[model samples]
Target: MNGFKKFLFRGNLVELAVAVVVGAAFSGLVTAFVNSFIGPLIALVGGKPDFSDLAFTVNGTKFPYGGFLTALISFLIMAVVIYFLVVLPVAKLLERLIKAEEATERPCPHCLSDIPIKATRCKFCTSDLATAPTP
Candidate 1:
């Protein structure tokens, strides 16, 4: 029971659980948006909002292609939203953070290793950095 409790309360595990819950909630929101807004927009052009009824019979087997198309559209919309709203913004923010972090460090010319910007010696090679070129 102790091990179980530890596993349940582990930081990464808890974070993952929260992420899954949030992702599911976001998926539902995207689905609702597709159903409420995108469906009507498509209907304005296609004359129908619901596509599940569209099917074709082949050898007594029904293929619901319209439903697949509707799902595809929903998936595309979700992908676009996630990419623009989450992925792109996160990427840009990370890039900015990396640049800021990089600005605090400089390469040790003797060892070709990273050292603090104000470092006067190369920790790796024990070489004097007083005359090293500054980037």
Candidate 2:
């Protein structure tokens, strides 16, 4: 019982729950934005973009696929927004924090290995690079 309490209240579990709640809230915002703004724009193109109204009847049975369209579009927009707004910035920040050696360092002439700038010798191949970095 004690172990179960510890497991339930673990930092990762709590953080995950918080993230899920926040994500759901953000998704609501995205849905509202898409429905209020983008929906009209799509309606202009698709003729009544409220997919809920767009439907078909098969053997006197109505098949409402407009709702599916709305949901798919909303989901796609949410994915794009999250990717660009959250994932991209985080990735760029981490990249900046841990700079890649190859980006700033020069490639060795002999072995094509990455080495420090202004290095006179290629550490990987032990080749003289005094004449490297040709003008």
Candidate 3:
């Protein structure tokens, strides 16, 4: 029972669960907004937004291009929202974290080359320098 609780509530698992819930909620909002507002607006401009009934006779076959258009729009909206809301912020946050890590990993300024954090001298340049004490 304890093991199952731990497994379910681990830090990463908790975060993942929260993310899933938030994502679902966000998806619902986007879908609703598109259907109620954007769909009608687009339909007003372009005529009949729901294309499931749209058919074109090519030779003897009917091609449903309206459904394809709706699918394409939904895919585009999903891509834009995911990219702008999730991917961009996550990438920026990761970049900031990497920069913070790299700031500590860099070698001494005088040497202008990579050396251990505790190193007092630039190994390649052989220049003496003081290193800040590690707390």
The whole-model lDDT of each prediction reads 0.84, 0.81, 0.78
In model 1, how large is the Cα lDDT of residue 80?
82
User: Which number leads on lDDT?
Assistant: 1
TM-score of 1: 0.76
| TM-score-best of 2 and 3 | 2
What TM-score does prediction 2 earn? 0.60
Structural similarity to truth (TM-score) of each candidate = 0.76, 0.60, 0.53
* lDDT tens readout by residue for model 1, 30-49: 77877788778878998987
* Per-residue lDDT of model 3, residues 40-100, tens digit only: 8778997877667777998999888878877997778667767887799999999999867
lDDT for each residue of candidate 2 in 1-135, tens digit (9 for 90 to 100): 999999998999999999999989987887787778777887898777656777999999999998998778777876887788779999999998787434557888779898888788888899998785732
After TM-score superposition, the amount by which residue 119's alpha carbon in candidate 2 deviates from its true location, in angstroms, is 16
By TM-score, the best candidate is 1
User: Where does the lowest 10-residue lDDT sum fall in candidate 3?
Assistant: 102-111
TM-score of candidate 3 against the unseen true structure: 0.53
